[model samples]
Target: MDAPERHPRIVVGVDGSDASIAALHAAGSLAGPLGATVEAWACWDVPPGYGLYLVVGIEGFEYAARQSLEQALADAFGPELPAFVHPRVVRGKASEQLIEGSRNASLLIVGRRGHGSLVLGSVSSACVSHAHCPVLVVHAPEEAAHRKKGSHARKSDDGQ
Candidate 1:
């Protein structure tokens, strides 16, 4: 008899940045091996301090943000990925949306910003701090290697 099905859901954040794309790739690799469902999420919102807020209104801003989110997901996932990969778009603070979604996810994944710092973007930092599940901060392999080399060089120079 076949074994019972067991698969965890992995959540990932996408924002069209190289970092986000890297995160998606990492999540896909893990999902494929683990038989897990990959949920690609993108969150959108207008900054509250913009003067255009009065003209755009909350509902209007939400509508635009949602549309952008949908387009972003479509562009990122396209039509080639497996059916088990699901795409989601939400309107709200990225951190809040990600943390809430993490409630049911087995793992969360995000990319390190292009600046190559552990200081995550606002959204990623929040997820790292508060997500209920394990979170993987994806970085380009070259970046990881570079950081390691830099650290080693510094240690050698210090003679300690």
Candidate 2:
């Protein structure tokens, strides 16, 4: 007898930013109708420069990172995640880890900007360049607001 096929996954990079939250929603929306799973990924890393500081309390850092991922997932979805969605916290650079995790995913989703910058974030840029699957970069809320304001301004100018 043949084994049953597993459900496909829609991988998403999440970091508690407004953009990441948007990406999570996008992934969930896509996963629902497709009967796919949503993998919410978050990575935490400490450079060699911070080793001394980390050595004093590495366990705490790990705990906090895991908590952050869990909290982000809860905040985006709810206290209880849907059966199709799950959260994972990995230890590595965001871009590299996310790229590796999305290898078997049907779609890889990320926010255009994370907590790092006002513009496009490095992780999103790296994922766009090197993801194994199709990539979807969701825009930040502020960017949507800006676009809306710009369109309204254009309409006023046209009316003048």
Candidate 3:
């Protein structure tokens, strides 16, 4: 007979950023308590101009992106991990893919910004706006912590 179904499933978008790493950690912690499995998704899209001219085209880009996603998961999860976790990489608009993936998920997590971002990124904004499930926006730690650490470092450097 089949085994019993798992509890809540979480979907997290990982783009290999600090915020995304934090989100993944948060998701894993939450999953541990809830007996849930995490579906780590990384989305990519071909660049509009140069990408369109490539001989390998969008499919090749997507394949490479999937490999990158696997590498990111390996970096995050490391070896000798349990079997409950899953990772997927899809090629499409990040927001749309995440929203679709989270339809059956209990929660969705994503970083505030990813590569090629100068400000609050668009994907996080879109997921918060559109995800069917509860959304978690993992931001960097409080500025006060950084300030305290910086002050401590400066004081030590001055030897005072």
Candidate with the greatest TM-score versus the true structure: 2
- The Cα local distance difference test for each model comes to 0.78, 0.84, 0.79
Off by over 4 Å in 3: 1-6, 114-119, 140-160
**Against the true structure, what is each candidate's TM-score?**
0.74, 0.84, 0.75
Sort by lDDT, best first.
2, 3, 1
Candidate 2 wrong stretches, greater than 4 Å: 1-6, 114-119, 158-160
Q: Model 2 misses residue 127 by how many Å?
A: 0.4
**Candidate 1 at residue 81, lDDT?**
59
Q: Least accurate stretch of 10 residues (summed lDDT) in model 3?
A: 112-121
- Tell me the tens digit of each residue's lDDT in model 3 across 1-160: 9998858999989877667767777887888888899988888887777754477556776777777666667666776444667888877878899999988999999877633543457888888888899998887555337658999999999997
Model 1 lDDT per residue over 1-160, tens place: 9998657999988776667777877877788788899988877777778777767576776566556545545555665756877877677788899999999999999877735454677777888999999999877567778889999999999996
User: What lDDT does candidate 1 reach at residue 43?
Assistant: 75
Candidate with maximal lDDT: 2
1-160 in candidate 2: lDDT tens per residue? 9998978899888887778888988988898788999988877887668878675866665677778778778777888788888888788898999899878888999988734444567898898889999999998778889879999999999995
Error of 1 at 155 (Å): 4.6
